[model samples]
Target: MTESHPHPLFAHGTLLDPQVQAALFGRTVPTTPASLTGHTAGPLEIADGSRNLRREFGGTVEGAVLHLTERELAAADAHAGDDFARRRVLLGSGEPAWAHLDARPLRPAARIVIVGDSIAYGRCDPQGGWAAHLAAAHIASNETGHRVFNLAIPGSTLADVAAQTPPLLAPRHPDTLVVAAGINDSAELLAAPDTTRDNLSHLADRLTPLAATALRHNARMVVVGPAWLDETRLDDYEGLRFTTARALALRAALRAWCEDNHIDFIDLWEPLRDRPHLFVDGVHPTPDGHKELFRHLST
Candidate 1:
């Protein structure tokens, strides 16, 4: 293989197995001993209830560099599946090579069900929203059997989410339940500034039952707070006016409720606060915004 044409892949674990190599490539390709610095490999759960090596910071992973053709590279990607994502890294031999690293925190395959409002449903983004981006990542990687189900409605409120969840959970019974709501509820902010705290309290109250339902199903729950909004575009949504202050208040309430309930909380307010370009109409995120949301969720 010519140096410029074929690709070099660093194989630390299963890829080094002869049987696995033959099965994936139809033949064993040439390999040279290699080592990757600043990473340590450890057993991590993968899809199909199997274990795979997950790389972490602070050590070295002993492996080999396998030369592969374009076809073989594609096959290697398929073989890597959802457990890992291919990244170019400089090896100990001073050569840049592709290496498969943990795609997300190493965990067993799971069914993640997302419930919320339009943002969760992918409103302004042509590529869908954050949920769609998440689902696409899983599909593209094919690394794990993780499945994401987005059940967000355009104008859903906390009550709407609570009302719809039970029926949906009956069928999916997901391993993880993600709730991203509160933007619609913040509409009350248009009425009066004092309504901000009231809205917060109201949302906290509504979260109680919804969280109970998640606990009943024994599903790990994650609550995603509303994203930062552009006050200048609030007028675009006819009759709907919510300030960034209200959104921030709602986010704080959501965080507090999650803390009290011992559930995971993802705060979208602070992270997207300065990135106004990510929003298309103040209420919904652009495709890039959704990408950013997905990145936060993954990490």
Candidate 2:
């Protein structure tokens, strides 16, 4: 027999606030006084300089168990943001529940550099792209010692990123290098599929050296794949053709390369596929799209 668990969300911090609950779920959810045993909660510093709950062994953290629907649980996840990771734990009342814990470890502030194409450049969005949103969030948090640099150029390919990366390593060494390219690579896919695949391979080969250099310097490398394009509006832009199928191919190739190289990969294809309102020209994301991208990137 399979075990059945209740959809209980244990809140020890902001989730416990009635106002916050109203803001997040649009109404107050039913919550019961509860506590988690075998753990203690304390102040945990996040990238934004805000303090959240951090758990340690050998004590109990008092909180409440909220009854939420699956949709509400997702909302709770978004409310937790990138600062926390959600997991399942047993409450003192012997009920299984979800809890958000600090996601970042205590470490010195580090610099993050993003390199990519027009999407990463925040084109069509007044608030800039996802990179800009991330930077703004960090700035607002006043995360001292942390910095984000957006080195993305419009219409850039993977090869272009290879050229733009090395110059920053010497004077502006980043602790994390984010490469968010490949949508443009798929532009040629409709006409020249083999050539596009070859291009991906060549680009991966070219990036290997750069990835090696960054890894040698103790820097983490993250590769973000392409977002889904609107086929209806794809040909509208200066006769440039792109398809969702081709974008998926490129995303898969990029993911494979990242796996082979032992690097982190973020896929924007599926997340942005159904979000048509988030796109302005079907290629570049609107302000809302960029915000969505930032949410995915941060998490």
RMSD of each: 15.9, 12.7
Per-residue C-alpha lDDT of model 2 across residues 136-209, encoded as one tens digit per residue: 77655556656778888999888888877887765665656778887777776445435535465576765687
TM-score of each: 0.61, 0.61
Q: Which 10-residue span in candidate 2 carries the lowest summed lDDT?
A: 101-110
Q: Which ten residues in a row have the lowest lDDT in candidate 1?
A: 48-57
- For 1-299, candidate 1 gives per-residue lDDT tens digits of 55467788888666777777798899888889998764555576333222443333234678889889888987887777865656455576666677765554213225678899989999888888788888877656654545778888988999899888977986875656788888888775434545434555688667888876765554456788888888887853666677888787788888887766555677777657778798888777888888888887767
lDDT of 2: 0.70
Task: Report the CA-based lDDT of candidate 1 relative to the real structure.
Answer: 0.72
Question: Relative to the true structure, how large is the alpha-carbon lDDT of every model?
Answer: 0.72, 0.70
Q: Which ranges of candidate 2 are over 4 A from the true structure?
A: 1-109, 189-198
